[model samples]
Target: MGFDARFLELHAAMPRVSEADAATSVELDYVHFSVVLDTARRLARVTGVNVDGASLVELDRGGDDWQLDERIPADWQAGPAVYARNDLDRGHLVRRRDPVWGSPEVAARANAETFRYPNAAPQASGFNQSKELWLGLEDHVLAHASVNGMRLSVFTAPILAAGDPAYRGIRVPLRYWKIAAWNSGGELAAAGFVVDQAPLVDTSEARTPLPGEVPDLGPFRTFQVPVADVAALTKLEMPELVEADRLPKTIAAAGWRRLETSADLLL
Candidate 1:
């Protein structure tokens, strides 16, 4: 099975891709998550996963191997080739541990499914302040959700901006976004965030590396943004999530709030 739209008490539909790009996009369902791959960009347009904090399972990832999904052509995915001989990391859009819940066998399958290339995005290898904060967001949200029903629905994807610098026939995204949805008491609650590595990514032609050259990328800058802003930026239709946004309207009017730590989160 894949991500359940009704995983939470309230339903959260998967983000939709635009009609123009729909033809080239392939939706693939994994053990506990789903990815809508933008073949044209050789990356995922959106990925959704269901996390059950109460049932989470811990398993060692000692010998897992990254592989392409056999259902889709290798060319349609930004596989090992893009990350080969570079500082770019094959980042997981749906963090591996999020979906690795349920039974031991099921958790193992979920863990393996995460290694498929469609769920991977190219991110800077170096860790910095913002990147470290970005990586811890899900855990913080999960803990918050535990007070309610211990279930969460998370959506994530690269911005896929046209201006992103080109590398190995694919454009490297400078920004990525995440939306976490859960039930707060009897109401649906959600928060949106954007993390940028623009300064680290030198887009200048002279600095943009030739094939096989490692492109220089800088530290990440994280922000708590409006869900509506995320919808506008990625051209995804997610009215419900926007309406359920837990970020204060006052902060939304003030614009994106730079987040130095989880304490900066309004949710």
Candidate 2:
């Protein structure tokens, strides 16, 4: 739907963000995916639309030339720029050019929000490219309109640096991801999943885990969340709502409530 009310109800805790700003629009199940992230990590993004049904659309933004913009929580902070050193390109979830979304500015923001190093997986440039199989799945899921309430899932585990506190719990160098979304009761609903399977990549451990104890995230599961929700969760931290947390929320307090998927049909 153009306006997502289900998203609003699910992510009421997060500040509203523009479809133009970087963010997700819905949550989905991971087990249903051919692959999944086994780690006990979480990624709650706010869902938005960018069409790529015809083909993969790579963003025009790239390193050095690309600007870094973010809305961080005042009390929380990062130790340093993690992805600064590496052949890893800033990968994005929301493509900047999709027919559903007209202007490049809005898609730029959505792609930007997912640009965080935490949201990235250590991939060969070929693997991360939009034309690749993995990225193709992402576009398919994003463009899907399930006939039933069933939807796909999309979630990710941060690829951490070796010896860093965040990697201590990780048994595998590969990260995790899940995605799912569809329509219900005249509104669109979404869910996300996590499982101990299908590691997307294998690289040297880049970070240390907390207390040096590997975390068991249990079995694959699901949760409903808004499309605009993006919490600064690492491999260790759990996600929660902050009354006034900074984010794209820094832009303004606007969110979709009972958002309409097909405004023209509804009208």
TM-score of each: 0.95, 0.37
- Best model number under TM-score: 1
Candidate 1: where is the Cα deviation over 4 Å?
145-147, 200-206
TM-score of 2: 0.37
lDDT tens readout by residue for model 1, 65-157: 999999999999999899887678889899989999989999999999999999999998879878988987888887554336688889999
lDDT of 2 by residue, 1-267 (tens): 232323322332212323432232223211111111212322223323323333323575455233322333311212123234534334443323322232456445544444432333333233322224334443444444432322222233333324222422222323323233333343434332222222233436423335633322222112222323423222222233322222234332443122112220111
Error of 2 at 57 (Å): 9.2
Count of backbone clashes for each model?
2, 61
- Give per-residue lDDT, candidate 1, residue 172: 90
Q: In candidate 1, which residue pairs clash?
A: 200-217, 200-218
Give the C-alpha miss distance for residue 104 in model 1, angstroms: 0.5
